[model samples]
Every structure is written in C-alpha cells, then in structure tokens.
Target: MNTVLTLMLVAPLLSAALAFAVRRHDQLRDALTLAGLGTAAGASGVMFATVAADGPFVLRVGGWHPELGIVLVADRFAALVLPVALAIIFVVELFAIGQRKTAWGSNPELSGPMMGVLTAGVSLAMLTGDLFTLFVAFELILVSSYVLLTHQGQAAQLRAGMTYVVMNLLASTLFLFGLAYVYAATGTVNLALLTERIPELPDGVRLGIGAWFFVVFGTKAAVFPLFSWLPDSYPTAPTTITAVFAGLLTKIGIYAMIRFHTLMGMDQLGNTMLIIAGVTMIVGALGALAQSHVKRILSFHIISQIGYMLMGLGLFTAAGTAGAILFLVHHMPVKTVLFLVGGLIENDQGTGRLDRTGGLARRRPLIAALFAVPALSLAGLPPFSGFVAKFAVISAGIEARATPWVVLALVAGALTLLSMTKIWLGVFWGADPDRVSVRRPPGNRPMMLAATGIAVAGTLTISALAGPLFDLSVDAAEDLRDPEIYRTAVLR
Candidate 1:
C-alpha cells in the first residue's frame, strides 16, 4: 500500500523531470511522459481495488503523524475517483501524442512535462489528508495550466489566459484566507482534525467557514456567477490541454468542496447550495445554447453539468451524495471524450466554428459516430451513463422533496439536449460547406481515432457497469456522510 501510494504521487513528478531533461528527443520525451502517467494511472487502479477489498488506507509521508506531517488517504471516495481521473489524463496524453505537431496540438516540448506536473498535483490534491496540501496541489495544476495556455503566446490565448489566471488567483487568495481562518479557529489544518474541531466552533464561525470555502471551490468548479472566465479561458488552449482542463480541473474543485463541506458537517449550508446549484444549472445550459463554437459550447456545459453534482451534494442525503459521486465519475470521461471529438472536428475542418464546418456525417461517418455517443450521453439520453447518473441525482432530489431544484435540473437537462442538437445540426447534418477542405497532419488519424475509441469504450464500460459502480458510489458516499470513517482511517 505504501509503495503504491508513493508511486502514485512520485512517478509523474519523476517522469516529468526526466522528460524535461531529454526534451530534445521527441519520442523519448513522449515515452517518459506516458510512462509517468501510465504508472500513476496503474497505481490508482491498484489503490482502488485494494481499498474496495480492504476499506480505506492511509500513507503518512515521511512516517509523520497526521497532525504533524503530510498524510495521503485512499478512502473509498478518493480511491474511486482517482483511477478515472488519472485514466482520463493517460488517454488524453495518448491523444496529445497523436495530435502533436499540428495546429491544434499543444507545444510538444512543454505539454508533456507540464502534464506530468499536473498529474502529480492531481494525485496530491485528491489524496491529501489536509487542506493546506490541497492548496499546494491547486497551485501545481494552475501553474502548469498557466504555462500550457500561454505557451503558444497567441493574442487570444494570452487574453484568455490572463482572465483565467486572474480569476484563479483571486480564488487562491481567498483559499489562503480560508485556510488561515480554519487553522485559527480549529488549531490545525489536517482535515481529520478539522472534521472534529470545525463543528465544535460557534455556529456563526462554522457557517462562515463553510460559505467561504464554497465560494472558493465554487469558482474553481466554475459554478454560476463564478464561471465567466471558464468559457473564455478553456477554448483558447490546445484541444489536448482543453480536454484535460475540461475533464479534471474544475472537477477537482468540486471534489474538494464535496469532501470539505460534508466532513465538516455543514448541513446548514445545504439550502443555499441548492439555490446556487439550480441557478448554475440553468445559467450554464442557457449559456451553452448561446455559443456558436464547439469548445465554448462544451465549456458552458461543463458549468451546467457541475450544477447536477452540486445539487447532489446540496441534497445532503446518503442517496444524493451517492448520485453526486456517480455524476462526477460519469462526467469526467464523457466530458473529455466530447472535447477530443471536438479536436477531431477542428483537425478535419480546420476550425471548431459551426459556421465553418458541416456534413461530417457524410464526410467522416466515424467522427459523427464518435461524437454521437458522448453527445447523447451528455444530453442524458437513455441507456447511457449520463442517464444513469442524472436519474440517480434527480431521484434523490425527488425523495428529498426539493421540488424547485428538481424542476430546474430537468429544465437544464432539456437545454443541454437542445445545445447538443444545435451542435449536431450545425456541424454534422447541414450541407457541406462549398469550399470544404480537410486539414490534418498526415498519419495522425489512426492514433487519434484509436485514443478516442478507447475513451468511448471506457464510457460504455461505465454504462454497462453502472450498477456496481453506483453501489461503490453509495459506499463512498456513506463514508463521506459519516466523517468518523475518514477521521479514523486517517488518524489511526
């Protein structure tokens, strides 16, 4: 368990250093990058399996106690989410390999190493037993993303990157304040300690802390009113970078929010979160409908779909938390796959603008098929993982009798379907543009397609295994709702 945990945290950073040392060798750099990501991903799978069979486990870095030093816990929640998150990064790395040297690919020299840093940070963020390390993990992710977004140094990218950085910087500042407040009030930043100490504070301070961190995490999750930067920032990155951001970054914020809020027993904030979740869902879906670019549309949907997960958390029930967990797992890959398909469209048509492309169904039936699966799933169509997740969430909401929030969720679902239909009609079904000319780097199609096909298969696997997956989600949620489970596992 300790070895697996070490590899899970160290492999990516180690590989990143090696890749940077040998940046001149393209194949070697890519191989090192994949090796690091693959190792961490494999470790995540092992961790997940181990935790499933044996329950939660913890690694005390440097043999220090949880109260005095770093701790990494592989509870059911962290273990369950880690594999899917790391796997998405691995597959995106493969796609990046194929997409390199193209107009759409990130800078080949830097993307690999930066992704290594990003992967390590993701592992740290998810596994950390304390809040301060989560902050450090966020910095790792944001710093790498900042470089990734602006490395190309195009005017649009710089502009978008600035907005992205500024917004996140504000969130980081608030995060620091929140951390200080937490430590000042609770006497320690260790989450397990906080779990016991936070709720003992006066009601006012406790609620204030909960609300403060919600805003901080909400911004990262791109929840409504804090989401304007996302649609602007994400579309400007290379498709591979965008896919990683789309799949993991904001979700990490949501992951943190779920962990922190629940463990601290902040049920007083549930009604407020539900209100925000409703507005976030409708606003995001409506925003998606208003976009003409594929990436931008998807970007809005990211915010919209986050609303569902937030809604689940807001319900503050075992069932609702389970639904939220399922939604998180389903959204990560499905969202990543959608962006990849967008990349394919951009590669083929030389643009993601709906106005600049059409008739992909006739010209490239495979791309159409690739886009259709995740698209329908995104729209919550039946027999897809999205449907299963949405149903769990909505069913939980109904049981909780949060009728207004439920109605907004359904409205958002309808808008999401409409947005997907708009993309299909504009990009795949209309007559081919008069001067349609395909643009792609030679010999890249097979690898890109294969990578995408693998992701699609993964999504199908999620759908097929939805039953068992939901069972695990519920078990994870049970642990989350009952904070003693986490505290015991970490402090033991």
Candidate 2:
C-alpha cells in the first residue's frame, strides 16, 4: 500500500524530470511522460481496490507521527476519486502526445514535463492527510498550470494567464492564512487531529474557519461570483490544456470543499452553500447560453455543473455527498472528451466559433458521434451517468426539502440542454464554414482520435457501472459524514 501511494506521488515527478532532461528527443520525452502517468494511474487503481477490500491505508512520511510530519491517507473517498482523476490525466497526456503535432496542441517542448508536474500535484492533493500539505499540493498544481497556460506566450494567453494566476494567488494567500488560523485555533494542521480539535472550538470560531476555507476552496472551484476567471481563462489555452483544466482543476476545489466541510462537520453552513449553488447554476448556464464559441460555451457549462456538486455537498447527507462524488467521477472524463472534440472541430474547420462551424455531423461523423454521447450526458439525459448523478443530488435535495435549490437545479438542467442544443445546431447541422481549401497536415489524427475514443468509452463505462459506483460513493460518503471514521483511521 505504501509503495503504491509512493508511486502515485513520486512516479510522475520522476518521469517529469526525466522528460525534461531528454526534452530534445521528441519520442523519448513523450514515452517517458506517458509511462509516468500510466504508472500513477495504475497505482491509483490498485490503491482503490486494496482500500475498498481492506479499509483506509495511511503513510507517515519519514516515519514521523501525524502531528509533526506529513501523512497521506487512502481512505475510501480518496481511493475512489484518485483512480478516476489519474486516469483522466493519463488519457489527456496521450491525447496531448497526438495533439502536439497539430496546430492546436500545446507547446511540445514544455507540455510533457509540465503535465507530469500537474499529475504529481493532483495525486498529492487527493492523498494528503493534512490542511497544510493540501496547500502545498495546490501550489504544485498552480505552478504547473501557470506555465502550461502561458508557455506559448501569445498575447491572449498571457492576458488570460494573468487573470488565472492573480485570482489563484489571492486564493492561495487566503489559504495560507486559513491554515495559520486553523493551527492557532487548534494547535495543529493535521487533518485527523483537526477533526478532534476543530469541533471543540466555539461555534463562532468553528464556523469562521469553515466559511474561510469555503471561500478559499470555492474560488478554486470557480463557484458563483468567483467563477468569471474560468470561462475567460480556459478558452485561451491550447485544447489539451483546456481539457485538463476543465476536467480536473475546478473539481479539485470542490473535492477539497467536500472533504474539509464534511469531515469537520460544517453542516450549519448548508443553507449558505445551497444559496451559492443555486446562483452558480443559473449564472453559469446563462453565461453558456450567451457564448458563440464552442470552447467558451463548454467552459461556462463547467461552472453550471459545479453547482450540482455543491448542491450535493450542501445537502450534507450521505446520499448527497455520494451524489457529489459520483458527479465528480462522471464529469471529469465527460468534460475532457467534450473539450477534445472541440479541439477536433477547431483543428478540422479552423475555428471553434459556433458561428463559423457547421455540418460536422455530415462531414466528420466520427467527431460528431464522439461529441453527442458526452453532450447528452452533460445535459443530464436519461440512462447516462450525468442523469444518474443529477438524480442522486436532486433527490437528496428533495428529501431534505430544499425545494428552492431543487427547482434551480432543474431549471439549470433545462438551460444546459438548451445550451448543448445550440452547439449541436450551430456546429453540426448548419452550413459548413466557407474558406479556401487548405489541406490538413497528415499529422497524428489517428492517435488523437484514438485517445478521444478511449475517453468516450470510459464515460460510457461510468454510465454502465453507475449502480456499483453509487453504492461505493455511498460508503465513502458514510465515512465522510462521520468524521470519526477518518479521525480514527488516520490517528490510530
């Protein structure tokens, strides 16, 4: 178990270093990067299975106690989410390999190494057993992402990267301060220990801490008013970078919110979270409806979908948390695949502006087919994983009698479907863009398509396995709702 956890964190960093070392050799760099990601993804799968069968596993770095040193835990929640998250990164890296040969790919010189850094950060963020360590993991991710976004040095990318970096910097500052506040109030930053010490604080102090981290994580999650940076920033990056950001980055923020709030028993703030969730839903959907560009529309939809996950967390029930977890799992690959298809559309027709694209359903039926499944899933249509996830969350809200929030969620779903329909009609059913004939370079289209196909297949697999996944989520949520389960496992 310890070896597996170590590989999940170390393999990526090692691969990243090696890839950077041999950056001049294209094939070798790509191979090393993929191998590292593959290793982490495989380790996460093993950890997930092992934890499910045995229970949570903890790794104490340098053989030190939790209070004084770093700790990593593969609890049910981490175990369940890690595999999906790592798998998405691995698939994106594969797509990146194929994409780098195309006009829309990220800079081949730096993208491979940077992606490795991002993968390591993600693994660390998910597994860290303490608040301070989580913050460190966030920096690792933010730094890699900053470089990824701006490495091309295009004017628009630089402008958007500034917004992305500044907002995240402010949030990171607040996060550090929150860590201090937590330590001052509780005398330690270890999550398991905080679980014991936090509830003992006064109600005002306790909720203050909860609300503080809420803003910190919520900014990262791009919820509500804090989300303007996401739609503006995401669409400016290369397609592969945007896909990873859309799929994993904001979701990490909500992941933290779920872990922190649930384990610390922040149920009192449920109403506040619910209100924010509703506003985020409507605002994001409206933003999507207003977009003319495919990437921007999809970017806005990321915010809209976040509202559902927040709604689930706000319900603060085992069912709701499970719903949120299931939603996170479903959203990652589905969102990534959608963005990859957007990339394909742009690469094929020269633009992602919906006004400039049409008739892809006839001209490139495969890309159209690839887009449809995830699009329907994103719209929460029946028999898809998104529908199952949305049902779980909305039903939890209904059971909790959170009537207004439930209504907002339903309205948001309708708007989401409408926005998706806009994409289909504008990009797939109308006249194709008019331009001079330019032959596409016989680049790595097959590899890109194959990578995308794998992701699309993964989303379908999620839909097929929804029943068992939800049951697993329920167990994870049970652990989350009862802090003692985590507290005991880590502190024992």
Candidate 3:
C-alpha cells in the first residue's frame, strides 16, 4: 500500500521531468504524459483496493512515525476521491490528445509540461498527510495551474492568470502562516496529532487559528466573498485546462477544510461554517445568473455548489459530514464533465456566448445528449448522481434539524436548475439557424467522441453505483468523525 502511494506521487513528477527533457519529440511527450497519468490512475486503483480490503493505510517518510515525520494517509474519504480525481485527469488528458491539433497546436511544449505537472500536483494534494505538506502540494498545483491558464499567452489569459496567481499566492501565504501558528501552539504539524491536541487549546487561540485556516481555505475553495477571482480567471483558460481546474483544484481546498474541521474539532466553529454556508449558496447562485458566457455561468455555479458541501460540514453530525463527503465525490466529476463538454461545444461552434450560439441540439444531437446528462445531474435531477448527493446532504440537514440551511440548500438547487436550463435552452434547444455553426473537420470526430464518452461514463457511475458509493461515503464520514483509526494507523 505504501509503495503504491509513493508510486502515485512519483509517477507524474518523473514523467514531468521526462517531458521537459524530451520536449521536441511530440510523440514521446504525449506518450510520457499519458503513461504517467495512467500509472498514477493505476496506483490510485491499487490504493483503493488495499484500503477496501485492509481498512486505512499510512506511509511515513524517513522512517519517522506520524507525529515526528511527514505522512501520507489514505482512509475511505481519500480513497474515494482518488479515483474520481484520476478519472477526471485521465479523461482530460485523452481530450487533450485529440484536441492538441486545434487547441494546443500553437504551443505544445508549454502546454504539455505544465499539464503533467498539474496532474502530479493534484495526485500529491489528495494524498499528503499534514497541513504544511498540503500547503506545499497546493503551491505546486497553483504554479502548474498558473502556467496552464496562461498557456495561450493571450492578453485575457495573461490578465486572468495573473489574478489567479496573486489570489492563490495570498492564500498560500495565509495557509503557511496559519500552519506555523498551529505548529507553534501544538509542536507538531501532523493532522493526527492536531486532532488529539486542538481541543486542549484555549478558545481564543483555537478560534483565531481556525478562522485563519478557514479564510485561507475559503479563498482557495472560492467561497462567497473570496470567489470573485474564480469567475474572472476560470473562463479564460483553455477549455481543457479550465475543466481540470474546475473539477479538482477547488475541491482539494474543500477537502482540506473538511479534514481540518474534523481534526480540530467542529464544535469550536460550527456556527461560523453555518453562516458562511448560507451566504455562499445564495451569493453563488445569484452570480451564476448574471453570466452570459457558458463557462462563466458554470464557473459561478461552482461557488454556489460548494455551499452545499460547506453546509454539510457546518451541520457537523456524522450524517452531515457523510453528506458533505458524498457531495464532494459526486460534484467533482459532474462538474468536470459539464466543463469539458462546454469546451467541446465552444471548440466545435467557435464560441460559448449564449447569444451567439443556438440549435446545437439539432445540429449535434450526440453532443447535446452528452451535455444534458451532467447538466441535469448537476441541477440535481433524480436517478442521476447529483440528485443522490444532494439528497444525502439535504437529508442530513433535515436529520440535524438545520432548517434554515436546508431551505437555503433547496433554494440553491432550484436556482442551479434555472442556471443550467438557461444554458440548455439558450445553447442547445433553440432553433435559430443563423446562430448555429460547425467548424469541426471530419477528422475531429475522435475528439468529440472522446469527450462524449467520458460524460456518459460519469453519469453512469453515479446512477449505477450510487448505493455502494454512498455506503463508502458513510464509512468515510465515520472515520473522519472519530480520528482514532487514522491517528493509530499514522502514529503507530
């Protein structure tokens, strides 16, 4: 298990190094990127199998135990997210392979290396065990994402990437500062240790540190006030890059928030999360409604959807936490597919502006079908994964008797439906022949097929595996609610 986890982290970095060294060989570069991501995905599967059969697994570096050294911890929550992350990266990589000719053809060298590094960073972020290590992984992801966002070197891309860099660097600094405060007070950076010790700190210190951590992570997760950077930056990146970032990066921040809240003890800051969660939902949805571009609309909804995950965290019950976990797992893939399909639509039609596009459903029926599944699923339609995930969170809210939060969540769902349907009607279902066009050559069939396949598979995974996956999420929530299992495995 430890070997597999180590391989997962190293495979991409090693491939990245190889990619940089062999930059001129297009075939080799593409092969290395695919192979590296494939290996990481395989390693994720192995880690998942090991955890399913053997419970939790922890790997300590330098022969130092958890409290004394860096660790990589994998329990049910981490395990479940690992595969979803891998799947998103894998599909995006495949799409990149086909779209490279039209999309990244101008600067293959920059796009290739940056993407390898980005995939590696996501793998590391999901597996690192402590706050400091998580910070380092996040910075790695940020740097890689910056390069990807600005790969086109367009004026808009540069401006958006710069904003993204500035925002993330600030978040990284606050994260490091908060981690220093946490370590200075507790004398260790290990999450397992922090879980046991945070409760003993004075309320003033605890709340202060918790608040710093929340602001830092909230910024990264694009919550409420801190989310302005997201809409500006995300929609300008190359579609593939935008899709990957949309799917994984913010969720990594959300994952860290969940881990820290559980470890630091949620009781100390439940009310804070409760208030933030409500505001995030309302504000995010309203922002989504204001967007006219397809990517921008989806980007705004990302912030709103995050509120549901935060609501689960705020409730802090075992069930609420479980719902949050399930939502995170479900949301990442659904959002990724939506964004990728959006990219494909924009690529084929040459624009994502709602006013400029229409009648895609009649022109490209398959693409329309692919887009509808995740879009509707994201809007929380039943028999799809989104519905199941939202049901879990809303049910948990009800069970916890969080009436206001539940109402906010329900309203957010309705607004989400409105936002997605806005896209569907304006971009897909209309009949304005003058507003529709197709630029894809016959050779581009593979690209469309690849993107469509992924969207279909994502919808199927959620619908068919809902029962087992939700059960896994439940177990993960239990492990998180009681950190003894994690602590013992890591520290022993």
TM-score of 3: 0.97
Give me the runs in candidate 3 sitting further than 4 Å from their true place: 103-106, 433-443
- How many backbone clashes are present in model 2? 0
Tens-place lDDT digits, model 2, residues 326-409: 999999999999999998888888888887788999988999999999999999998888999999999999988999999999
Report residue 175 deviation for candidate 3 (angstroms).
1.0
In model 2, where do residues sit more than 4 Å from their true spots? 436-442
Per-residue lDDT tens digits for candidate 1, residues 279-365, read: 999999999999999999999999999999999999999999999999999999999999999999999888899998899899899
> TM-scores across all candidates?
0.99, 0.99, 0.97
lDDT winner, 1 or 2:
1
- Model 3 C-alpha lDDT per residue in residues 1-492, reported as the tens digit of each score: 767988888888888889878988988987988888888889999889889999898888787877777888888788988888887787787777677666422266677777778777887777778878888889888998888888678999888888899999999988888988998999988888888888889889888988899999899999888998999999988777888889888898899888888767756688789889899988989889988889999999899989999998988898888889899988988888888888777876778988888888987888898888888888898889889999999999899888998999889889999999899888888776474455544235576567658656976787789999889988988888888877887777
lDDT (0 to 1) per candidate? 0.94, 0.94, 0.84
